[model samples]
Target: MAPMGIRLSPLGLAVFCLLGLGVLYHLYSGFLAGRLALFVLGDQAERAGPGGPDAAPGSLPEGTVDLRELLAVSVLAAVKGGEEVKRVRESNALNEKAKGKTREGAEEKMTSGDVLSNRKMFYLLKDAFPSVQINTEEHIDAPDKEAISWDRSIPEDIKKIIQPKKVPAESVTVWIDPLDATQEYTEDLRQYVTTMVCVAVNGEPVIGVIHKPFSAYTVWAMVNGGSNVKARSSYNEKTPRIIVSRSHAGKVEQVARQTFGNKTVIIPAGGAGYKVLALLEVSDKKQEKADVYIHVTYIKKWDICAGNAVLKALGGHMTTLTGEEISYTGSDGNDGGLLASINVNHKALVDKLPDLEKASHK
Candidate 1:
């Protein structure tokens, strides 16, 4: 016992550290071994050709990390590299659309440089939150290109829910702007700005953001639920409010009356983004401590992705009316309809909806 006082000296400590480093190196080596093939071939290399130098046709050693996790991380990294590509496309598209909005002025278009500024806003998001990936495959592309213009002439309300993404996998989708309201931005039409971004978390938009750049705002909500429906001035339990389309004057009026009652102080504005902003402003207002906001209508994916991020950051949710999670796996990039709410728990929407459905049926 007396001899054991300092048996383990600095040499022993050094040896322990060496063993720890050795264990770490082994783990690192295993991970690298599993990913070597992926790096050379890419995610879809198996379909590239019969066999390549990098292709591994055998099993991995035991204790190796799961390939699926590696795949997810790899895909995520590649997608990030391409985010700026999306920004460039958005900039060019919006710049082209801005000319359209200018003509719509009275109406008023965003400045020629506004498109670039808007692109920067997206960059801000990427820089600020590295974890939240930007997947813009919200049906912005069209098969024939000719189909693109055709989709635009359709009713605004109708186009809002039309799916546009080419679902690449259970987790991947291609977003196409069949019609991203060029007439509004081109002609300076304030309320005409609209586009959708389909989102998927393992192929779903647990949340979405719908932006109306001309209005300089956006609408966000989770895909599986609603927000707390609180106002800026008071979190007081007042009548639920619905943010409707401003450009579609008639529909907006109808929705306002139907959802908030004839006496409801209509939160009038332009773009779906405006509607969501109104709710958020009210929620943030010191006068209120409210819990949620609600959007009751159709909106495509691109229109909601960014805003969904914001709403989610602020503790809100957006979802479909059927109590299903908002998903971007649809062939086109749109869902039939979406129901957004603030602060309201997702379960509450389910628990309370059946009774509302029954009452409506009556």
Candidate 2:
């Protein structure tokens, strides 16, 4: 150390100073490069520096509970947007003479709540969490659309079981249904209207939220974060109550009737989301709860993702009629049909699918 301090000539000293500065700069840049952060405000989002990992496509940190809370707020805004439409529809501002006459007239009849909510939800998500991959039933055509990165905050237990080898090299993707049960919403079946948001990590539904604007009830769940409302099954009775679609019952009613017989009461409700919730909802008058939810028709992933998440979180089951689990990031259409119930043993209903097919063919 004494020799190093005393032995430098002019040229050597100059070279050493330059080298030291170079090393310091390299260290500083290395430390600060990836730590750049973003700050967002109402309609004003700003980036402090340009070196976030999100700058790289399909790379993001794991999501956390904060993301779930953000998702909940975003979904609630969608529900509020739908409420706005319902409010206007009930206000009598539009003349009753032109209800459901033409395509434009029909759109005007419902007040564009679905599209409006879809737009708001997609845009708000973009502004707040810029790195998430988003898929929606309604396509948004914003020019500056950018998919950002997300540092997923997965549950520890789930993360342990999910092999790192199985996770795809992509950011988390969220599927959104701004408004579920459009037909029921238009028909003023307010109870059936729901806004849904689902987050799929590695093609799995890890987080889901179902919001009902009319009832001001919201249910959400994560892999480890249980639902706000715990699901209680009313399945002890010999005869179980079942729910089917009011608009698209299809072979479900026929197969259900064949399997459960006349003693089983099949409650017809609108919206797959609403039907799922009915399993938990106690009837106002009769105080009865649904025991099973069956839908043996083609449905979309967005329609069932939130409900499925809620049901699974409540220790219930939601799967294809063929006893297959619904894949969130797979095909948009669920072709095999769906069967969901809380507290009821799934094996009984799952075993009946073959008999249902046989009976339907007859």
Candidate 3:
């Protein structure tokens, strides 16, 4: 009465177990492949959200792009550009020419170093993040082929400070000054020369890299993400050593003297990058170190964006002479003049300056 069930042979039971195992293995493999696809094609996958695959790269929801990866790529681009700058200088093949006139009617020079470095940096950045906006100093057609390969490795020091974070790709703007001190470079003042890169999100610079090719020195920072360099501990606020452009020092010198008094010690220097480095106490020469950098004339975003990011990382400020924060969104030139200070009261410094326009005319 209890024995109505038919029993399977041992061989049949073994085959049944093998078939079940095969099904499980297939499912496991499928799961892994899905994850791999997400990792490899993250940008495209994220972009293909509710808007479909044709959606703009920045149209994806905010906080979807990894900023850390962008920072690493920027550092690589800057260092590579620095290498190119050094090479052109060493070869004595600048082929320097007056590219155009600045806002103040000074002859703005462009050299082989600028063109070569711009090509090197631009291609690297564009290849890595095609969606991000890049503003370089020079305008050149994209090459038929990219010679530089992308490097994804982040610097060890940078890795220690920055954490995983994301921003909208559309909100990111990269500013590149392939050769910051071209005039200084032509004058054989290699110490002032630098290759710089900056990452500005929503018009706020969040990352900066300044590489001095001659010295093989690099300092980088991410705003609120820490920096490899430290802010200068001691500031001569009493005498307040001020750094101004050697070529365009006349107006700033007059302003510095008027604001900080005749004893303010106006140190004429070349390169916005160098002046910012001076404020950070990154120079070996004592004279290069300063309390503030003043430029009472027109300036470019590419020239100061990296330095601005670095200063912001160190709890400093760079703004217009009127104490208004400069915007890097629309135009390349900032005619409000520049007022930058590190570990010092920026507003207080701005308050001391006489009317720059009146002072300049006088």
Candidate 4:
């Protein structure tokens, strides 16, 4: 035999070619499917990189940390603070002291509850996000070096709602009211007490977390990111019920009466956070439901920023008496008087209001 020669018929060659083509098509289809899956998942590549999801909390440089992570940290801090509030209240050791006088000449007080909660919340956030600016209601010189423990996990529902993005530390600000309604807390009005945290990006509140220590309830929202609480479907626009501060009710009641008529039901409550929750209709008690929240005279940003973010997330608006959006960057005080509403025409309500100053005089 000279040399064995291998030969294939035309049909055999065609079959071989078809088999090769099928293999290539399968490989190509698999590659394309993977790319499509990554695209739909949103920022999966970013999360896999440094300072991403795999990185430990506080391991990344300031501002490089993911916003979703920051939001989760803030939620943890708020709940931790709420726990402190409840602990101190149950101990019956408020040790309340007068902090100073409010702009309206009312005595502003601080207590052990405020200090402990503030320390807990501030350190928790600062440890997780070292460079982000944090503004807390209480001022304490001591550092909490007790090795705070918190679960860095974000809730699946929350993660589903918030998109992935990294915000620079310089552009982010965290406001913490460790113990809102301390006065009410001292008065045994535990329902009004709340621990709140707000994350403002570029001077606008984008994330809000409010926790009621007494009831162990928490409601949070991130702008464009979803809220745990649902907005009220119905609003009483005509003769609308309004929620005002029980502590600062005089001026707001007068203004609300002048604007919405004397028949307007003015529900007096404590704490800005509580009043805002009422606007969202997330009240434990039925009487706390209201159409709008009105405040006259000065208010602090920490007192209302969380509420503002919550309102904005729900497609509502919170602004000045003259319908101006409040800025959270520079001064902490809002002197324009506060007007917040959901489900109703906020502008229409603002337009009806008389001058706050003139109304106060009357």
User: Quick one: best lDDT, which candidate?
Assistant: 4
Model 4's lDDT to the true fold? 0.84
Q: After superposition, how far is residue 210 of candidate 1 from its true place, in Å?
A: 7.6
lDDT of 2 by residue, 200-276 (tens): 77666766777776766666666656555666634743466778877445556665666667687878787777777
Tens digits of lDDT, candidate 1, 160-212: 43222212233433232222433444444545444433334565443344444
Model 3 steric clash total:
0
Model 4, residue 130: displacement in angstroms? 0.3
Q: How should the candidates be ordered by TM-score, best one leading?
A: 4, 3, 2, 1
lDDT tens per residue, model 4, 1-362: 79989899999999999999999999999999999998866676566665665555555654465677777888888899898889988999999899899877889999889998999898888877778899888885765443675567777877788866677788888999999998899998998899999999999999999998888788989898788898988998888888888976776777677766889888889899998888775756633788988888788999999999999999999998888999989988888888899988888888888676454333
**Clashes (N, CA, C under 3 Å) per candidate:** 80, 13, 0, 0
| Full-model lDDT, candidate 1 | 0.40
Candidate 4's error at 71, in angstroms?
Answer: 1.6
By lDDT, the better pick of 1 and 2 is 2
